[model samples]
Target: MRSMHSMRIASFRVQNYKCFVDTGEIKLTPGFNVFIGRNDAGKSALMEALSLRHTHNPHRSLETVRTPTSEPPSSAPTSVAYDLSPEELRQHLTALASFFLPTGPNASASVFATFRSLLETGDRFNADWANGVVVKADLAGLGGLRRDANRYASVLNLAHPSDVQLALQNEITGSYSSYGVVLANWLRDKAYAFRAERLGLGRCAAGPDKVLSPNAQNLAAVLNVLSSSNPARYKRLVEHVRIVFPHISGITSVIVEGSSVEARVWSIPLESERSDLSVPLNQSGTGIGQVLAILYVVVTSDLPSVILIDEPQSFLHPGAVRKLLEILRSYSQHQYIITTHSPTLITLTENDQLFAVRRQEGTNVSTVALIDPNRQDDLRMSLADVGVRLGDVFGADAILWVEGKTEETCFPELLRQLTKTPLHGVQILGVDSTDELGAKNAQRVFEIYSRLAGTASLLPPAVAFILDKEQRSETEIANIERMGRGMVRWLPFRMYENYLLQSACIANLLNAEDASSGKAVSSEDVQAWMERHGGEKKYFAPREPTAYSDADWPQHVHGAKLLHDLFNEFTDARVSYDKVKHGVLLTRQLLPNPSGALSELCKILDELIRGAPSYTE
Candidate 1:
């Protein structure tokens, strides 16, 4: 086996390929190389061109590669096969003559003399490049058998032209196998290309697969193969999937109902009372099939020097997306070329993985900005600090995406707590799985790593986020942070509302609401309120009920419920659930106070603002 990091497309040169009038040279490295470009910007075309070298079709024609230009190349480049000119034919014979010269085995005989004698007479009849001009061979005499094998040598008139023909028709040396010839065939095995734009992971076929299909219809079979062939690699694939969807217990191949072979991911709920569940790969998220298909190809194919993946970041959890990129990096022996629109994908990519691609207006030709080798790190870090996602630095905010409206409403209030005065400029916003007006995760600072990851990108620019810890597992949280989205903060209290529910704080709020209500509330009343409304599973839901007494009511009472009940118990102006946010805001006015939990949480929020990337209008 080759070293883990052995294959890479050092550089690529293409001409007359679709959309690419002619991309001169694209240098690549053995890692996650991302191509960031606009639609119709030739990103896909570049990937297609790279895939061309591995293609073998005798009938593949050059017409498909034409630039769609007004004038095509003098001749076309064919996909299936090539048609070599007479000049090209002579070069092959000459190369063979050089290798088989009168030496070694034929030390005294000088058999090559017969081959050179025939090369003197070349193609004088047909001249494609030079119209109406012809050059004849100089050969006067040669043996019949040797002269016939070098037929193109006479046809070319000993002239040389760029050869396109890949097939060899004859071997004059009378050898069934030649070192150069056999080695050339073996080299093709060292590299190949896989285009996955339209992979069909679910289109079922009853039988097992000899190899994975382009659409991944045979994904299950491939998974089975990988497991049997290399268990460690198979385990790594499962680990990658687990990072994307943490609930997954394992991945397996199953022959369902006798005919259909399927890849399935099984999930075991965090709760032991729940039974483990399994879903067919096709029935799972589209990203799952895509991720699995890619891993199967890269990990098991073992032949390709380069892998071309277009928009690989689509439909992937930000964690899975990073995991996929890391796989490409770890397998540094092979090269990866990827195109993407996801900023999350760009977030974790190192500077070298980036390639900013753009097409000139009204032109099919696209070009990549060459990052100067010397300034790559500085330039990359600078872009990252300024929040240029996937090479696009737009007008966005240095906002914070937090849970609950209280987080949003508490923004100005949070600053007041920390600074003793409200600070303006930085914004704090809230968004969730449900599409909210003005809540696009596009500029989200931190996306919650729940099933709601699909909607995470639909937010205004916080350019960073810190998901509140609730049912989230530590591993899941760490996986999300590893994706470089943002920090995940565990609330010091039961929830954000708990910050405002402290006994001392509640006592102070009651004092503000009613002078007579200034006295501390008994913990028994707080517990009573929780037991009453806690069935609804609001912010204060806990698995076990804990009793509380005076001075500790806030520890047990739901903050919003406490405020609601406060008005009913004392002051009479109706306090609705909506008004509790205002109540929380009011409570924050007394914060960065003596309360340890609320104050500490406030400091963390304050530091988040200070540390996250900031953008301008």
Candidate 2:
């Protein structure tokens, strides 16, 4: 068994394959590698190109896979080159020498030494697959070795010692007649490409073969073999299946007609007295089949394998996807190459290499940007400080930016009550302040947000900013609104706390909190407090008589300050108002009969939700 850190495919280059004209040597990590991009961005093309190195039929026509162009297909035959690490190069050379050299007179040792010497002086070794597979080496400084090759040919009993180079090439191209077939066979034993659509329902001819097929078509046969040959591993597989599907007590294979085997799941009965039911795996949900196939691959494949998965989340739920990722990570001996559009998967997987693939419109070439590991770490920490996961931002249909943490918690509840439905597709995010943008006008701030959102692929598509009107003049308010271009709006009040100034609701919240302390508050107490503080004149009066009405006084007063003073007035009681705690309580109390300000806010949100685009899988 190879060590967990054994040399794997370090990097690969693809040329003239579908959308990839020339993907210049995209690097990979030894552990987990992830590719993220939008629809039709050529992510799938890159995956297919990587899988080409392990294909069985190396002689397949290039016309079907080659990039279409005005030039002849022969001029641009599809090619994929894999760079070999030093360890891998040594392994291949060692194997080649052992297989070809005569046993006596230390012939194998001499040939291996020659190969090693060539490797030491060479710049790079690449396994290029185009018309056929060939190991290309930059042996520029090995002219003396080629001239003196007769020394190796004599021991190997070559017919023509002068043509030693030809004989060596023939030997490198294995007994399969072509190095392409040899390389393909080698990769087939070490790599597995998992495509969910290609997986068969768990049934296959019973055989002693324990190796799983690329698409897991032989899953049943593989399981049957494992059950008899390796009982411990078989038990482990059943235990893992139970973890992912709790209802499944065990997995068993039953031979039918003395020839074929079918995998079945034993479902635990709902009642203790009832016996467990055995059902064919085909009868189970597609999600379970996917999970079983994935688990079988991860659990049974040889060590140091390269597992390529395309959008596992497409077939599994978020929870199942998370569990599957955990299983994959636990098996640290294998390398993983996964492509997904699911932000949740990208956020959860701590990938060794992360690439953002993009292709311009009307172009066949695709480009990849490798996100720096340090930057990704910084992003994770920043999101953690805000109590958010990157997936949360990408999963929403639209983002509603609020002033602070208090509004972030209370706005959703208020909107849910007014609309009679939870805010399903909208995510309310709290910003430090709109003033942080340092823009003189609303349009400039919105423009900055739009530009920032444009660069961040994980951010939600539609964004709307809502903030307090503060002390802006009427003329200034009108100008801001006009310049906003529908992407920004003001609260029409000093702050969100202004809407929670209802005397009855405030008093009700206070009494509820003071119930255990043998103290109570009434609506009259709140009303009298307001009256003592100058009644409507003190709270609602405008500087100009004809400017606004007393009913609109909540818009001008400092409701947060007033609420704090009201809480201080209750010195005899044990209850006090907190902006986050009491603010939400007061908002809930006002749900039964929302104030005029809240109703208008609800109207604005409804319009925004209707216009915003909904998220799709």
Choose the strongest candidate by TM-score: 2
In Å, residue 566's CA in model 2 sits off its true spot by 43
The clash numbers for all candidates, in the given order, read 36, 0
TM-scores of the candidates in the order shown: 0.44, 0.50
The total of clashing pairs for model 1 equals 36
Error of 1 at 545 (Å): 57
Please provide, for model 2 over 1-617, each residue's C-alpha lDDT reduced to its tens digit, 9 standing for 90 to 100. Answer: 11223536667776666565666777787778887776676777677667764332221123334555434333222333333344444444444422232112334454545544544443222345553344332222222233222122222323332322213322222222222234444654456676556355678888887877766777888888888888998888877776556568777787877699998877865254332367777777777777776677778865466888777766765545654665566676677888876654553223367777766566545676676644747544433322344344555546777766577767766655587433434566666532445545454656666677769466676557787765567887676666555666677777888888888988888777777656677898887786555233334334422212367566677677678778777645355567876887788788888877789888886666556555211
Q: After superposition, how far is residue 530 of candidate 1 from its true place, in Å?
A: 64
Residue-level lDDT of model 1, residues 418-455, one tens digit each, is 64421222445455422433344322423333323346
Top candidate, metric lDDT: 2
lDDT of 2 at 464: 70
Q: Which residue pairs of candidate 2 clash?
A: none
Query: lDDT of candidate 2 vs native?
Result: 0.60
